[model samples]
Target: MAELRTEEEQVEALKRWWKENGLSLVAGVALAAAGVLGWNTWQGYQENQATAASMRYQQLVNLTAGNDLDEAQLPEARALVDEIVDEHGKTLYADLARLMDARLAVAQGDLAGARERLQSLADAGSDNYVAGLARLRLARLLVAEGDADQALNVLQSGVPEALAAQRAEVRGDAYHALERREEAATAWREALRLAATNEQPLYGVQLKLDNLGLESPDLEGSALETSSRDTTSHDNRGLDA
Candidate 1:
């Protein structure tokens, strides 16, 4: 009779403990499970979004791959580019689409449209490489439009090291246009030096220097002769001017 009483007391104590803590323990487990499920759902959603963006960007690329786009195909290509820009405006794909859109506008003789697109990318702070490329293109267009001062201003805004050679060349063009011969020569010399450092040959810079009565050391006889033949025609061409 004594042992039975003791077992009953122990059973009662366990029941009381569970009654005090069971609901809280159950609730804590439920909350943890819910949190994990929510995080997995969010991860899945982001993966799906990235996949959709990649597919759309590939479609855009296919539409613009070749130089054989005829008049009828151009509108469709441009429409696709616009759609990517509208839907994925904050993505890298959208920035690339803007560049392609600008090129399309140039092809269609829409200089104003092209300029606007290029200027938007140039002024944006998102991607330094894209901004630098846009600045270079815009500067070239401005120079072609006879706005050399504006071109120079654009180049002065700064560029990536990868674009330094091209920028200097265009600066030379702008200076030449403004009749700043000394400045033009200096810019071209810098461009040539940069190109050499990059292991890229700037073929005509030396020719231009020669026209300016400047000599490049160790130029081959055949090269000098060939360059002289074209000096009169190419002296004013300026690198990518």
Candidate 2:
């Protein structure tokens, strides 16, 4: 009889304890499960968004791959660039699309628009490689626009080390534009050396050197002869992409 009474008292104690704590215990478990589910859903959503962006960017690349984009195709290509930037502005694809947008502006003979886009990217103050690319391209445009002084000013600040070859090349172009032949020769020589060290396949540097009455070992193969003419005519070829 004593044992039975002790067992009954213990059972009553457990029931009272559960009544006091069970609601909070159950709520805690429910909250944890919801947190896990929410995190999983968020991850899935991000994956889907990235996939969509990749597909769209690929489409843009295909459309703009060749130099023969017709008049009708140009508008379509620009629309894709806008769409990528609008939805995925923070993405690499968006940055590349902006680069393409700048090129499109050039094709349409909108030099001012090209400068605006390139300058925005250059001044974004990011350490991204794309920013370095932007600076280089912007310098090219500034030179093309007969703003060689401004181009030199833009290049006064540094670019990504990987882009040092192109930076030197552009400096040469700017100097060449300003009729500073000796400095252009010096910069072009440095560019050739750095290009070889960087293995970055810089084109037309040899031709520039040769034009300046300096000879460099051929660096760009068949491009050695043609690069000078292309750059002389276009002033925007050989962007480091």
Candidate 3:
């Protein structure tokens, strides 16, 4: 009889312990399961969003290929670009779309629009590569517009290493426009060096130097050649005297 009584007491103790902890344990497990489900759902949604954005960006690219975007195509291209900007503005594609839009503006001879687009991208702390590209384009446009000083100022801020050669080239152009021949030569030389380091093809810099009749080696040699010529002329004058 004592053993039976002890068994009953033990059963009662177990029941009370379960009553105290069972609900809390069940609730904790349910919360954990919900959190896991929520996380998975969120991940799936983000993946889908990215895929959709990529498709849209590809469509934008297809519409703008190899043509000047004639009047009929222009509106469609612009609309597609705008849609990308509106829906995926935070994505890399949006920045690309903006860059494309700037190019379109240029093709249309809308210099002001292109300048505005490029300037905003450059000034807005955009992705480093895109911003560097915008800055380079803007500087070129400024040079084309006969604003070499402003072009120089625009490029004074540093660019990404990938763009260093292009930036140097543009700087050289601006300096040449300003008739700062020596500075222009220095910039072109730096540009050539950077291009070689990056394995990039640089054109026209050598030609520009040649046109200046100051192709570096000749620049040094020209002074000596001129002095020699002067000395010869002086000797001939002495003979004549």
Candidate 4:
């Protein structure tokens, strides 16, 4: 009889514990399942968005390919750029699109618009590579527009290490525009050295140095090696996208 009573007491204790914790346990499992479902849905949505953006970006590329920016081609290309930027601003595609848009602006002879777009991207600094590229291009435009001082200022900083060669090249251009031949030669030499280090092909830099009566004998093999890699290379600026 004592054993039966003890068994009944244990059963009652278990029942009470379940009554206290069962609801919370069920709620926790439901929450976990819901969380998983929500996460999957979010992932699916993100994948779909990425696919759409990539497709549209490809269309933009097709339109702008080969530098065939004719009257009919420019409008469609610019529209595609706007579409990608507006719909997918968070993606790298959008950043690339904005850069393409700047190019379109330049092609249309809208220098002010080009400057605005480049300035905006450079100021965004959202992506270091893209921002640095924007600054470089903008500096070139500034130098072309007789604003060499501003170009020099723009090239003073914010360029990425990967693009240090290009930055130096643009700085050289700005200095040349300002008739600072010695500084231009120095900057171009630094550019050649950096380009060699990074194995990035820089066109006409050696020629610029030659014009300035400067020579870098250490770059003889570098020039041949880097230029050899250039002919087979495709535009990889969109890889970030």
Best by TM-score: 4
Clashes of each: 0, 0, 0, 0
**Against the hidden reference, what TM-scores do the models get?**
0.65, 0.73, 0.69, 0.76
Comparison by lDDT, 2 against 4, better one: 4
Ranking of all candidate structures by their TM-score, best first: 4, 2, 3, 1
**What TM-score does structure 2 among the candidates reach?**
0.73
Clashing pairs in 3: none
Q: Which tens-of-lDDT digit does each residue in 1-241 have in candidate 4?
A: 2123222322343354356556874565466657467756655665688799889987986787654467789999989998998898876678777877887887788889998999999999456667777787788788878898998898888887867887887888888889999889888878878877776667666666666775455554566455434433222111111
lDDT tens per residue, model 2, 1-241: 2123222322343354356556864565466657566756655665677788778877876776655446677799899999998997765667767877887787777778888898887778233466777788788888877889999998887576767877999999999999999899889878877766655456666667777885554555343334444343334452311
What is the C-alpha lDDT profile of model 3 across 14-92, one tens digit per residue? 3543465568745654666575667566556656766887788778667766533566677788888898889878666
Candidate 1, 1-241: lDDT as tens digits: 2123222322343354346555874565467657566756655654576577667767765665554446677798798887877876765557666766776776687878888888888898355666776787778778777889999989887577866876887788788778888888888878767766665434466666666675544434443344334433333221111
TM-score of 3: 0.69
Question: How far in Å is the alpha carbon of 129 misplaced in model 3?
Answer: 1.6
Q: How does residue 63 of candidate 2 score in lDDT?
A: 77
CA lDDT scores, all candidates in order: 0.65, 0.69, 0.66, 0.71
> What RMSD, rounded to one decimal, does every model reach?
23.3, 21.9, 25.9, 20.7
By lDDT, the candidates rank as 4, 2, 3, 1
